[model samples]
Target: MLLLSGCKVKASVWKWLHIAISCFVTAGGLLLLKHSGVVTGGTAGLALSLSPILNIPFHYLFALLNLPFFVFSYFYMGKSFTFTTIIAIAILTGLSSLDSLLPAFTIPELPGAIIGGAFIGIGLIGLFRNGASLGGATILALYLHRKHGINPGKSNFAFDFIVIASSLFAYSLTNGLISVLSIAVTSTVLALLKRKLATVKPGESRAIHPASVN
Candidate 1:
């Protein structure tokens, strides 16, 4: 088990605790990809895509792009959630930078994609359950799920499709295809986990099936 902020914070403390765990877990996944020279999907992938053309590093692009989502989250998910998400994003951004510090290591693309993608999938589920997110596409997907009753998993998959497609133009086709596979694994995990967390309303719990959404 895990303990954070003692018991005084009560239920709200879980949000912060999960946010911290999710940050490191997600960052670890990205770091694995960095070491192996692979890419995944979603807003992080979009940042990777933009990194070359913008001549900006990936972490900076990722952090900057996610800024707009906080506004959307504030109105839809409420102040507490938006604030927690902001802190989570900042922590994740910082943690991901530590990729440079990892000892020289490398792995084949396929295994790297599977392991790295699994880490991200688990981390994202943790964030979703805790009423926080990694921001960017996640924020939009969660807002749509909470407000309009769209299924977050499916919506997130759609966003990943776009992100992966755009990646083809930025990197080799093979790398982009590997990213698609990685995201497919991530989305499948999200779908299964979403069912476990499903609830009928926002501020209730996570999960909504696409067919169930109105």
Candidate 2:
């Protein structure tokens, strides 16, 4: 049996349930940030920044931007992980699309950044714990951590910072700065949970099969 936080649990329907809940949480957080007119990081942030400029919906852009990353994931992360990641992305994308049906609402920028970041972070933790990711820079971060022992949090933060910097083109300086705060909050939460997430040694199987764990 695989050791998960020193506890043994068989993989079952719980894995799918975890992924679905995590995707829902992440989608809710992204919707909050979207309504606040702030972007965080990765494909989601890029999609947010580009949606208005490109005159496309966020969910559509989100899926399109992730195409290249899926290729990278397939090559580096193995089929099982890649498949699971694709499913996660689809779920998140579907959930994001539902925002159009909800009543229009907006959150204050600062609180949206803080609370949305926390929700995204917690959702990511659940995904990672289940050997899945939301794709984009997250796939690269997890790949690096698994194969080269780089800190996923640091790598993820660096990528996120770049995304946020680029977002300055699409948003006000205040919103850009607030977006940075959101990413920082997310990074902090990931850092706190890093120890509990699994890491693969170099040369070990790079694919983290979710079917092997609960």
Candidate 3:
């Protein structure tokens, strides 16, 4: 019982740390995207598009948009996975919203897109390693990758194309293209990292069950 209690404590600590790191990176990426006047794919992109039009907070919209996805995820990803995902999403939502309070800063479009995409990718890696996800297109991509042997990166990028294309209506063509570049960078990095992470031992706590985030 003592050993079991110790393990529980360790797991709980790991979960909180994972949530913090992922949320920080995700918030940083979203801030950059916002400053660059762009959007990427997944639930985040939807939130970005609607936030301005609906005049709602991005964090609230992000969490609300993911509600249905959570239900579906519970069925597909199992209870523990879905629960962790909820925690991850909640943290990300809160942190991303808090980022609005940060002093204004800006970056060049191309560099912002690249760096922001990488940050998002890093955040997702943390979430995935912790058996959590942002829940949206990411859930679908992970499901397909796990069950059908499809490349999640390609699948994710395919969905992103539609999301970025739709943004052309809301943003300039240049910005839309930059959004695509961000998504491309995100997907590519995720693919490479996923492949590398696959080689890690489960005992190391780096090979969690497949799940996805926005």
Candidate 4:
């Protein structure tokens, strides 16, 4: 009984931590978009675009939009990955709704485009390091990459372009194109950094000097 109880407690704590981390990354990515006045492809972006039309907060809509994908993720993703992802999304939704609490910071258009992309890229890679994801087109990208020998980066980029294209109807072709470039650059950087980080020494997180890995 004691052993069982301890295992359960550990599971609960892990769940909480995973959710917290997911929420942190998701909110961080959202903050980038908020600053840039742009959005990306994925269920979260879909929610933001439709929220005003549906009379809902972007956060709540994002959570709701994820339901079907969560079901797919649960079946398609491994149990551990899916389990944490669900919790991560729940916490993210809660945090996203709290946007009012965060100060609204905008950026100059060009700088915003570049910095916003970098922030989202790094933030996503952080979530990936923790063994989860925001889930959407990337999930589809993963499926294609695994099943068809397609490069994950290329798959995601193509899908993201589709997302960017859709935005043109709502915003403008120019604005839509910029957001696409931003997401592509960011996700590409994330993928590159992820590959480099994976081969480094264990128990060390170093993006700079590995001698600094202490």
**RMSD after CA superposition, every candidate:** 6.1, 5.0, 4.6, 5.6
Considering summed lDDT, which 10 consecutive residues are worst modelled in model 1?
200-209
Better by lDDT, candidate 4 or 2? 2
Angstrom error at residue 30, model 1: 1.5
Per-residue lDDT over 1-214 for candidate 3, one digit per residue giving the tens place of the 0 to 100 score: 9999997787778666876787789788878888888788888988888899999988899998899998888887777778777887888887887877889877788988999998988787777666677889877776676667687778888887887787678888888888999999988888988764332222123433225432
By lDDT, the better pick of 1 and 2 is: 2
Candidate 3: stretches off by over 4 Å? 196-214
> Residue 76 error for model 2, in Å?
0.7
Candidate that would win on TM-score? 3
- Pick by lDDT: which candidate is best? 2
Candidate 2 segments exceeding 4 Å error: 1-10, 200-214
Global lDDT of each candidate: 0.75, 0.83, 0.79, 0.63
Worst 10 residues of 4 by lDDT: 197-206
For candidate 1, the per-residue lDDT at 82 reads 82
Ranking by TM-score: 3, 2, 1, 4
Query: Candidate 4: which pairs clash?
Result: none
Model 4, residue 90: what's the lDDT? Answer: 70
User: What local lDDT score does residue 42 receive in model 4, on the 0 to 100 scale?
Assistant: 74
Worst 10 residues of 2 by lDDT: 200-209
